[model samples]
Target chain A: MKKLINSAESLTADALAGMAAAHPDLRIDPRTHVISRADAPVPGKVGVVSGGGAGHEPLHGGYVGRGMLDAAVVGEVFTSPTPDRILAALRAADSGRGVLQIVKNYTGDTLNFAMAAELAEDLGIAVRTVVVDDDAATGTPDGTPGRSAGRRGTGATVFVERVCGALAEQGADLTAVADAGARVNAATRSIAIALTACTVPAVGRAGFELPDDRIEFGVGIHGEPGLRTEPLRPASEIVQDALAVLLDQLPPGDDDRTIVMVNGLGATPLLELYVVLNEASAVLRKAGLTVAHTLVGNYVTALDMAGVSLTVCRADERTLGLWNTPVNTPALRWGC
Target chain B: MKKLINSAESLTADALAGMAAAHPDLRIDPRTHVISRADAPVPGKVGVVSGGGAGHEPLHGGYVGRGMLDAAVVGEVFTSPTPDRILAALRAADSGRGVLQIVKNYTGDTLNFAMAAELAEDLGIAVRTVVVDDDAATGTPDGTPGRSAGRRGTGATVFVERVCGALAEQGADLTAVADAGARVNAATRSIAIALTACTVPAVGRAGFELPDDRIEFGVGIHGEPGLRTEPLRPASEIVQDALAVLLDQLPPGDDDRTIVMVNGLGATPLLELYVVLNEASAVLRKAGLTVAHTLVGNYVTALDMAGVSLTVCRADERTLGLWNTPVNTPALRWGC
Candidate 1:
């Protein structure tokens, strides 16, 4: 594969070193692979942490800073971090106000974070976990046979981290921070479409090949099979299809205010993301939803996939207030 | 070509609409394709304006906000903005304190922006122009034949816009702002290596292609021919070669502080960019330059090319101060 990397084996470590050099404000643990705030474990404040695979950058690591994640346990590309690494992040982030783990809804990540939470609690550190299952594409309605796994978390992880990070920074207790994260998770929904598959550095090939005239609808972040592959269409039609699925899953009321995030999976240009955002915003407005805050960029991504995910989070005064709170992270920084 | 665009003819307009929707704080003139500050022409503050082809996004448009460019005149992909369109942006950004035009050193961009400056001057608006020529790869020493064109401007335009933007926002006169921009441009050097060619939406194919195991060093943003095609090398070696050229072009003193920007050409992942930055930062430190500020992302891009450019701006205290000034723009926002 034509990638700007030394080798697949050293990809994660090399990137971590680069992160340390690029952001002096962040302290990277070479041994544990935990990226923590340079000034971590703030006394009397709840600590927030999250992590998953490595390819989706600016996600777990880029979000670590003064107002977002206290620590991020990084895994290899498309792989979950081990329980020990998660435990290490938890230990590093605990500041006596306890810690909240924002775990995405993936089998490996969910189990690993849970085990780590238990490990942290055993060490006398109070810990709470919030599972984010906001991807409406993989979700089913209540009482479905496969509904137990729930929706896979996607772009809403950013929303959860931002809002929950604000709450934690405000010296909220672990339970309160966890509750805020869960609340944001519940209010958020996302669906993605992939124009191309991303190649993991180690794989040296695309995860899947797409036909020239076809697009995958409801694709997952890790190239998981989407609901189906459909004939390629115009951007407006593609956007409408994704929006319909999202809105059907989480219908809005007239008075509902929503935060819309048009997230580029990977390799999608900002130009295209803006186009998708324009169409998505228009549809949301036509449906009588007030777009309170808009975030359009590559927040979450597959390594090099050309696609986008539209996320709509139902915002109330409390959620919007927390989102407006100042965040000074590498990826999502504003109002500070 | 696999792209998320409606049509080649409408790509620029669609992207502009998306930019307007994504950033409400910036004003986009549909008629002239000038992206300006919503509140422009601030009395007594010198205005800063820059523009070029539309493909290098977040370059001109994303830089328009409170502390950056007063206006950005956009053209069709890889094509210079018309003289009339550039004149429109100049007029829109003219304040009583006058205006500074930052033009990249591409032939068409330089000529058109210069013509626009002359037109603006005829209309009674003060205009001073700074032509950025910082690409070391395309440079020839003192008295070489054809040296009149100097070097092509590349990634350093971001540095020029930022430093000069701050100076203009601080009420510097047109001469002062233009001087700062020129100084930064002179002190900066950049070199890029491309692994793949980016396709223009209108072209419907890659600009060029290389063998599977070869890379083009010093490739221009518009896919201009580079210095040479070399066998694919590791990231460290690639970075070292690019840095050697940049450093040789603009050597630094023991105590000189510099800002390092690792910019991705459209499709390079952040993970790889950071890895490259990690190596680039180390070589600079070993060479005894103190990296004062680090920017790692796609600031300037070539459509969807998989490559990166490294820009090192040797900064004095004044340049660093200006670089640190608060900027609240769509593409680059911090310390607001």
Candidate 2:
């Protein structure tokens, strides 16, 4: 696959070791693959933890630091973390105040995180779970929208992590943090487009094939087939088409405020992301929403997939205040 | 090339417009392609300005904001900016304090910036220039390291902008900022490798072809030929080999403190970059150098090439302090 890796078997482990070496503030357990802040389990503050597959850079792991996630349990590339591993992260992250689990709405991820939460409760540690399913793409494999596996969580998980983590850092109780996450997830919508598929290290080939003149709209992070394959259009039109799905779902409100994220799936350059964001901002303004903040970069990436994803979240004064709060993480950092 | 661009003719302009739209704090002139901070020409503070070929995201443009470059003049993809455009940037960025020009060690960039500096001085604004030439790649076309256009500046350009930018933000005069940048350029060294060639949109083809089983070692940013080409090796071994070249150039000392940056050349995933940094730290320590800080990610990029570059800079107390100063640019930010 011509990737800069040692081997497919040790990809996640080697990466975690490298991350820990780079950031001294982060502590890692090599066996459990749980990366936590050195000062995790803050006595008075509620602990925040999240986990999923490891291919998405800066998702759960890079967000582990002050004013964000306390612990991040990592799984194999595009594979779910085990119940025991999630349980280990829960145990490591919780102090006296309890822990909150932010999970994506994948079948394996939800199942494993739920099992871990149940096991943590058996040990007298309070745990709460928030499942994020904010992808706005149409036509799942099953005809029903809410009946099948449901929309795969894509970009809203980033919102859930930031909002919930900030609230918890302010010493909010477990319920408040979990509720904040739920609200963010409910208000958020995301859609992605991919020009090329990503190759998993083990598989050693692209997940799917795409013609040069066509693109996949509403593609997922793992290179899953999108809602449909269509002829490639200009970047401006692609952004408008993606946000059309979001605008349809958003309720009309006067003086509405919004937070936008133009996230690169993997191999897309940061320059193109700014273009996507500029186009998204224009369409959002046309719909009477002010983009309060715009983040354009390659955060929450798939493994070398060439694409960009748009995340639009309805924000209030409180959400804006929390997002502006000082965050000191590897990927997202500002105002500190 | 399947790039997310409107057209080859308007890629840079479109990206610049998008960046300006995303960041209201920065002001841009479409005709001149000059981007400056809204608060540029801060009466008493020294101005920092940089420009080069476009294609390197977050280099000259993204570095324009508070505590960094006051202005960035952009050029066409892989082409140098015209002297007139650069003169415009110099004029806009200058306050009472003279402007310091940071130019990469490329033939076109150096010649154009020199002309611009002369024009700015003629218009009654003082100007100083620092040219970076830290690439450690072997086999220049002329076969002489000291002559024949010298080494093409690669990753160390980020260090030059940062350390010098921080000093300028702290009110360092033009000469002081230029000297700091020169010292950084002298102490820094960088080497890059490429697994695949990046395609320029206008060209509509890859810059060069490399077999799947081999890689170009010590390659320059524009798919320039490197010291040699060899069979693909594991990430760990490749890192060791790259460092061996640096170790030769680096003077040995007791308790030496160094700053390490593992830069991804655009298309490499962040997951693989951490692995490179981890191996680099191990090798640096084995050589008795104390690694003070390690920055890992795609700071300096080469379009869509799949590769990684390593930059190591010897640092003293002052250099470390300057590096810690808060930088609120679009790409790098910390320590407010």
Candidate 3:
């Protein structure tokens, strides 16, 4: 692989070193793999922490700043952070008011985060958890959402962290912050497709491959096999199908308004992403839905996958108000 | 080439549609390919307008919004916008206050922008221009700074747009705003490298190829060959070389404080970009220069090239203040 890294083993540590050097606002603890705001553990304010594998950048670590996650505990590429690693982030983020853990719905991630939350509680840090399972193609092969392996939380993970972090930064209690996260999770739905598979740093080759004329629909963020493979088509057609799957599962809210994110799966160009975004917004409008907010870029990503993920979250004035709150993370920033 | 596009001919138009759909705050005119703020022509406010070929996204178009470009005119990928298209944007942006055209120093662009400026002047709108030529590799093969063909404007174009755009938004007169852009172009220097060649949609193939163990140093944004080819190395080493070239040519400022941008050329993952950012910061510190501001991502880009570019501009309190001012745009947002 022609990747720009020191070595596979040093990828995470090296990247964290870079993060620490670039963002003095973040406190990067290499020993624990915990990246927290420099002034984290704010007195009397609820703390927010989120993390998972390291490949999907700016997700966990880049989001650790004002108005976003207080701390982001990252593991190696596509590997879940250990329980101890998660525990350290909890310790870093928690103040007297307690902390909330926003975990994705991967099997290892959920299990590890749960264990860490329990450990923090025993240490007198009251910790609450919200697991996001927004990926619509996680449960079964025929496009039915199930809970056996749980829906792999995809793009909406960014939304949960931002909204919940904003609520916490606004001085909401831990329970309330976690509740907000859960509500977002309930209302969000995501669908992903891949033109090419991502290659982990440790492995020098892509996880999978497809003929030039084919694509994997409903792919997971880890480059795992998706619901199925299909012939490649125009971007508009691809986005239309992805949006249909997402709309079918997106929870109903008080209004027919939504926040849309046309996320790039690492290697797709913004040119293509915008093309996808254009089609997605068109789909939403045709379905009688009003798009209240839109984000177009690589927020959460696979290592080097060429694909796009569409995340839609039902929105009301309250949720949008939370989204519009000032945020100063490395990845998502606005309002302030 | 495997790409998520309808066809090569429709690429730019489709992407613009998506851009317009995603950003309702910006009024997108399909006919002129002119994207201006819906509330543009803030009476008596200095109008900031920019345009260029379309492949490098978020460059000219995504930068259109509050405290940035008042309007952006786009042409087909890797092709300069015509005089009339630029004229349309100028008319859309001007409202009593004269318009400033911040352009890249490409032959076609310079010629067209000049023509458009004259056309706008005849139409009763005073027009001023600043042509950015910050790419360090464009001069001589030995890396000497010269004006022959001019240095291909690259990453620092973003810096110029942001700082100058902010100055205009702050009500600076047309000449002052254009001067600010010129000053930034003078102080800024950029160097880029590629691991692979970019594939234009019409071409449907990579412009060039590199062996698994080799790379192109000092590559241009448009997939042009750079200073030379070299064996692939670690991220830190590559960044160190790129920074050395940049520092060699970066103008001496009042102080050693500088603003650094580790820009991804479209397809490079943020993970790798941060690693480059980390190395660049270390190089700056080692050189006894202070990094006052840092921007890391695909702010400027090639369509789907796998590469990175490092840009550094000297920063004083005044420029830092302009940088820190609250600006809202699709690509870069901060300091509200």
| Count of clashes in candidate 1 | 0
Q: After superposition, how far is residue A220 of candidate 3 from its true place, in Å?
A: 0.6
lDDT of 2: 0.87
- Ranked by lDDT, the better of candidates 2 and 3 is 3
Instruction: Report the lDDT tens digits of candidate 3 across residue range A1-336.
Output: 988888999889888888887788789998999999889888888989999989998788988888889899999999999999999999998888888898888889999999998899899989999888899887543445575777888888889998998898888887889889999998888999999888887988889989988999999999878888999999889888888777887766789989999888888888898898888888899998988888999988998888889999998787899999989888888877
**What TM-score goes with each of the models?**
0.97, 0.97, 0.96
The share of true interface contacts that also appear in candidate 3 amounts to 0.74
Query: What's the CA error at residue B299 for candidate 3, in Å?
Result: 0.6
Model 1 chain B: worst 10 consecutive residues (lDDT sum): B140-149
Which candidate ranks first by TM-score, i.e. highest? 1
What is candidate 3's lDDT per residue for B1-336, written digit by digit as tens?
Answer: 889999999989999998988888889998989999888888879999999999898888899988889999999998999999999999999988899998898889999999999999999999999888888877654446565687888888888889888998888898889888888888888989998898999988899988878999999889888888999999989888888777887777888889999888888888888888888888899999988888888888888888889999988777888988878898888766
Off by over 4 Å in 2: A138-147, A251-255, B138-147, B251-255
Better-scoring candidate (DockQ), 2 or 3: 2
DockQ for all candidate structures vs. native: 0.75, 0.75, 0.74
- Model 2 per-residue lDDT tens digits across residues B1-336: 778877888788889888987788899899999999898887888888998888888777988887778999999988999999999999989997899999988999999999999999999999999888888884232325744888778787888888988998888888899999988887888889998889888998999999989999988888998777898988999999999877676544333899999998888889999989888989998988878888898888888888999999988777889998889888888886
Over the full model, what C-alpha lDDT does candidate 1 score relative to the true structure? 0.88
lDDT tens digits, residue span B105-140, model 1: 888999999899899889999999988888888885
lDDT of each: 0.88, 0.87, 0.88
